[model samples]
Target: MNKQKQLSEVTELWKTNKKQYVKKSSFSAYTLLIENHVLPTFGKAFHVEETDVQDFVFRKLESGLSHKTIKDILIVLKMILKFGAKNKWFEYTPFDIQFPTEREKHSLEVLTKSDQKKIMNHIQEHFTFRNLGVYICLSAGMRIGEVCALTWEDVDTDRGVISVSRTIQRIYVIENGIRKTELILDTPKTKNSIREIPISKDLLRLLKPFKKIVNPSFFVLTNDARPTEPRTYRSYYKNLMKELHMPDLKFHGLRHSFATRCIESNCDYKTVSVLLGHSNISTTLNLYVHPNMEQKKKAIEQMFKALR
Candidate 1:
């Protein structure tokens, strides 16, 4: 019988082969998850038992990792195991891992109407290129990376749209016992994420005069060939919030604020979903749609009326 290979050995082999197919950012994420979590737990094991994995899951949870993050780690582990099984280097067993039911409902952070208006008014008055990204995010619901990647050429004043095609991110790279980070410009997260968002009349007016003067190839945030990374842009946002004296919220809250305002305005779900570039309408509904007491009462009344 051939000797069983340890997970550490198979991981190195799998990574080498997988690197050829995945995007740089994805490969870096897989590598980081493996190095930080999977390898440490299962590195020497030739076979992983379902119970062992369940124990790992519990430990991770106890350590305060989110279920989503722990599941991502498991996905990488499974991929490596499957690769090993295909090559007859290790035994693979399908595992049914379960997580404890979460008691706390996850809530999205969004800016209040007054706060949103205040920030927009401030941006309009201050009007710097960097500040423009924040305004664009509030109006268009673009992700930080997508906004960071935007160049003047992607903005169409004539057409009244912002083309979202690319995103920028900094990812960790590990090679030969060395670790470093690289900034990469990559396609948006999904095909759906690449779409055109119509510019509001107010935003279009703000952008019109500047559009003719700025170099088309320069990024909107920096107004330069080099783009600002998400981390740096986040720091800028933090300072802006402090200066505005607004409640502390994540930069992602701008996106939620846009979606919330759209739903409140009675915009159709499908249109809102498409505008947000969600892969599916369900994602939009799940995140943004929650019936209030008034709506719930109306629904119950309508049901009773139908029964009568």
Candidate 2:
């Protein structure tokens, strides 16, 4: 029998291969997961057993890791294992892991329409480039990274659209046993995320005059060549919320509020999905399509009418 190889050995090979194929941001994420979670647990193992993985799952849960995060860890682990097996250095074993059922339905936080309006009204009266970023997110449903990456060139007044091609984020990188961070401007999360969304007339009016005068290459948020990273922008947003005497909602709630408003306005589910640049309609339906009490009552009435 051939001698088995250590998992750490397989991981190094896999990461080298993975780095060539994936974005720098993606490679960074995989490396962080592997080093922080996978390597310590299974670096020396020649083969991973199903029971060992199950126990690892339970331990991660006890340590307060979410099921989704643990699942991501397993995905990276399996890739390393598969790579090792293909080289005939380790045995391949498929493990079917189960998670405890979650009974409580977690609701997404969204801003109330009045609160959303308050912020918008304030921005319109007291306009600043930084505050406009929040308006754009609320109006167009762009993610924080996407908003941070936006430049004047991406906004087209003639077409009344915002072209979302890239996102910016700071990622951890490890090189030659030295760890550091890098801020990268890369393509958006998925191909679907690289899309064009129409701007609302209100926002379009605000942007049109500035589009002609501002440097096309300058970032929209800072009106400068240098872009603000998401962390700094998030801090600005938090302070803005406090100044407005609003509830302390996470920045993502602005996106949720936009999608929720679309649903409330009776927009078609697929249109809402496209506007939000969701990879699938199901994602939009899942997050923002829960029927209200009035809709539920109407649904029941229609069903009874058919029966009668």
lDDT string for model 1 (1-308, tens) is: 45789999999999999999988999999999998999999999989999999999999999999999999999999999999999999999999999999999888898888999999999999999999999999999999999999999999999999999999999999867899999999997779999999999999999999999999999999999999999999999999999999989999999999999998788999999999999999999999998655568989999999999
lDDT of 2 at 276: 88
Q: Where is model 1 poorest over a 10-residue stretch in terms of lDDT?
A: 290-299
List model 2 lDDT by residue over 230-260, tens digit each: 9999999999999999998999999999999
Candidate 2 has which clashing residue pairs, if any? none
* Alpha-carbon lDDT, every model: 0.95, 0.93
> Pick by lDDT: which candidate is best?
1
